[model samples]
Target: MASHLDLEEQEQLEQVKAFWKQWGNLITWLITAVLLAYAGWQGWNYYQRQEAAKAAAMYDALDQAVQAADADKAASVFNDLRERYAGTVYAAQGALQAAKVQQDKGQADKAMASLTWAADNASDDSYRDIARLRLAGLQIDAKQYDAAAKSLDAIKSADFAALASDRRGDLLLLQNKPAEARAEFQKALAAMDKTLDYRRLIEAKLATLGVAVPADDAASGAAK
Candidate 1:
């Protein structure tokens, strides 16, 4: 009985060896691939965290420079942050801060350039919208009316529709297109919240054009 049992064990061991010979390389490669993938994922996560920390620190420096009213230092730090961390929100914010500094320093052209960069390249749509709005305002001040209109036209935020329309109306009025201005003002009035004081201003604009907005229109505008 002992000899029979030893023979059975030897047969089982041989069978195991045969299985390994047939599948050992494939099983080893599969396990290695899984481990490599897991390691790569972990490494990438760590790298992203490190990058975010660096960007955050740079942004903090930018904020401090701005708060100290050091436009030159703020501009330098902002440029560095924008160049090194363009993919992060910090870069867009830095661009805005740099633009503000340039504007405050009476560098209108530089401010416009910075705002244009942010408008064109910001990762967030809201930030881009803000940049475009500011750039349009500057263009208007410069009497580059056509360019200002084009910039304002590019804004697509539903929530900002009323303000954009009002700006367009103002631009049209400046261009001596009273009819078009009236139309834009009406659109603005339609889009604005009825409760907002700005809506009353728009209504006044429409009234100035001899377009009487109904009371119901005003109430409905407030409801919005």
Candidate 2:
């Protein structure tokens, strides 16, 4: 009976060995892959948090510089943000603020550069749209009328369609094309929300161009 028990135990051990030979490597590899993937995911999350924290600190510095009227320091910090954290929303916001500062200081070229960077490199669509609109405004100020028209035309966001049309009218008016401006203003009026005070401003613009906004439309706009 003892001999039989020993044989049974030995058989069980051999069977276990055979199973390991057949599938052990696969099982080990699967566990290893899972562990590595989990580690990588954890590492990625950590890296993103670090990046966000760094970006936030830099943006704070940039904001302080802007508030202090230190254009050089603001530009330096913004350039750092552009180079180091361009993928962050903070960088885009910094660019917008930097552009405003430059514009206030009459540094049109610098403002254009900052706005161009935001328009080209911002990760968010809305930020890019805002940058493009501001860039178009700067282009209009620079007497780059054709470029402003093209810039306004290239805005693809449906949310900004009315504003783009209004900007296009501004470009046309600057070009002394009142008829085209009036038409664009009408399109803007059509696209804008009736309840927006901005719509009334557009109507006033049309009036200034000697185009009467229909009384019915005005009443509808007012009622809303």
Candidate 3:
């Protein structure tokens, strides 16, 4: 019985060896590939963290330059951040800050350039929307009413709809198109939150056009 058990164990060991001989190399290569992939992923995460930290530091410096009212320094830092880290949110924010500084310094052309860059390249849609809104306002100030209207028309956010409509009304009013202005004012009134004083202001505009907004209906619509 001892000899029979020994023979059985030997046969089992031989079978296991045959299986390993057939598949061992393939199994080893698969495990190596998986480990390499995991290592690469971890390395990439570390690289991204480092890059973001550097971009954030540069953005802070740009903000400080803007706070000091150093338009030239702010512009230089902002350009560097935008060129090097355009993929980062901080870069877009830095551009907006630089644009505001340029505007305050009476450099309308430079301000528009920064705003246009932010509008075109911001990684965040919300940031791009804000840039476009600000650019439109500047265009309006420059009396480029048609271009401002076109910019406002391109904005698609429901949250910005009221403000965009109000801006459109302003542009139309500036152009002496009272009927078109009234239409935009009505749309603004419809989009605005009932509790907001701005909604009342829009309502007043509509009233001037002999278009009465029903208070109860507006309140009920807002409640919904």
RMSD of 1: 2.9
Q: Model 2 over residues 158-190: C-alpha lDDT tens digits? A: 899999999999999988899999999999999
Model 1 pairs in collision: 194-221, 194-222, 195-222
- Comparing 2 with 3 on lDDT, the higher-scoring candidate is 2
Ranking by lDDT: 2, 3, 1
Please give the CA lDDT of all the candidate structures: 0.88, 0.92, 0.89
Q: Each candidate's TM vs. the true structure?
A: 0.83, 0.90, 0.85
The local distance difference test score of model 1 is 0.88
Name every residue pair that clashes in candidate 3. none
Better of 2 and 3 by TM-score: 2
Q: lDDT value for candidate 2?
A: 0.92
**Deviation of model 2 at 72, angstroms:** 1.7
The segments of candidate 3 whose C-alpha lies over 4 angstroms from its true place after superposition are 1-5, 200-224
Error of 1 at 199 (Å): 2.5
Number of clashes in every candidate structure? Answer: 3, 0, 0
Q: TM-score winner among the candidates? A: 2
